[model samples]
Target: MQRAISIDQKKIDRYGKINGDNDIIHYDDAYAKERGFRGTLLHGPHMSGFAAEMGARKYGAEWLYRGRLHTKWVGPVCPGDVFDVRIDEDGVLTASVDEQVVLVGSATLR
Candidate 1:
């Protein structure tokens, strides 16, 4: 299965509020630039959640109860970046942004 996920400032802010992650880099573009990032960066956990969602969408309820997801953040996801989440027939999962891999992992329903 495959899906497209767009990262935006409103989503980031909401996630931050829910997760109590008030880091300036994830919210302030100027601050993130000063810190050497392209713009407001997405939190790692948020990306992890997207991976899990992809799994659940493909595998249904079993994924929710028995899913195992492993993800490595290889690069940053800035606001407005559209990421592609894809799962191969072998259940290998990958998430990419701008044609570049930003997250690599596997998702399986055990």
Candidate 2:
């Protein structure tokens, strides 16, 4: 299964506030851009939420109760970047931007 998703600065900022991560990489466009990112970056935890949610969708309560997830964000996700969260029959998940895989991992039910 696959779903298209888009994140904006407002969402990123909200997630940062919730997590108390005042990192400039997540809130300051100029600071992030100067550091070579396209813009403020999406939080790793926030991106991971998509993976978890996808797993729950596919596996229901078993995912919530017994699932373990392993993930890595290999590419930067900038505000306004459109991406996809996809899980295959094997339960391997990936988040991609512009066809480039940014996050790769798997969720296993214990």
Candidate 3:
């Protein structure tokens, strides 16, 4: 199955603070624009939620109760970017942005 997720600037700004991230790229539109993004990119944790939610849907909400979930950020998720979130049988989940791997990880939701 495929899941399409879109992240916005407000989400990015709030997530940066909530996740203890003070990176200018996450909260400064000028910085992001200078770096080529329209605005701030969402925090890794916020994007992780998309994958986690997908896992819960696939394996059942209780499945994550005792599992270890880990994700690595390989690419940035900018505002207005739409992407796919999918999982494999081995419980590995991936987030893709236009066919490029943005994040990869696995969960112990057994």
Give RMSD to native, each candidate: 1.1, 0.8, 2.2
Location of the lowest summed lDDT over 10 successive residues in candidate 3: 59-68
lDDT of 1 at 11: 92
Candidate 1: worst-modelled 10 consecutive residues by lDDT:
83-92
Cα-based lDDT for every prediction: 0.88, 0.89, 0.78
Candidate 1 residue-wise lDDT, 2-87, digit = tens: 88988899999999999999888999999999988889988999988888888888888898789899999898999989978888
Question: Per-residue CA lDDT of candidate 2, range 46-69, in tens?
Answer: 889889988898899998789988
Which ranges in model 3 have alpha carbons more than 4 Å from their true place?
A: 36-39
Q: Candidate 2: minimum summed lDDT over ten consecutive residues — where?
A: 76-85
Instruction: Name model 1 segments beyond 4 Å from true.
Output: none
TM-score of each: 0.93, 0.96, 0.81
| Candidates 2 and 3 compared by lDDT, better number | 2
Evaluated against the true structure, the overall lDDT of model 2 is 0.89
lDDT of 3 by residue, 1-110 (tens): 55897777777777766778888888777888898876777787876888787777777867657666788988878877886888888888888888779889885564
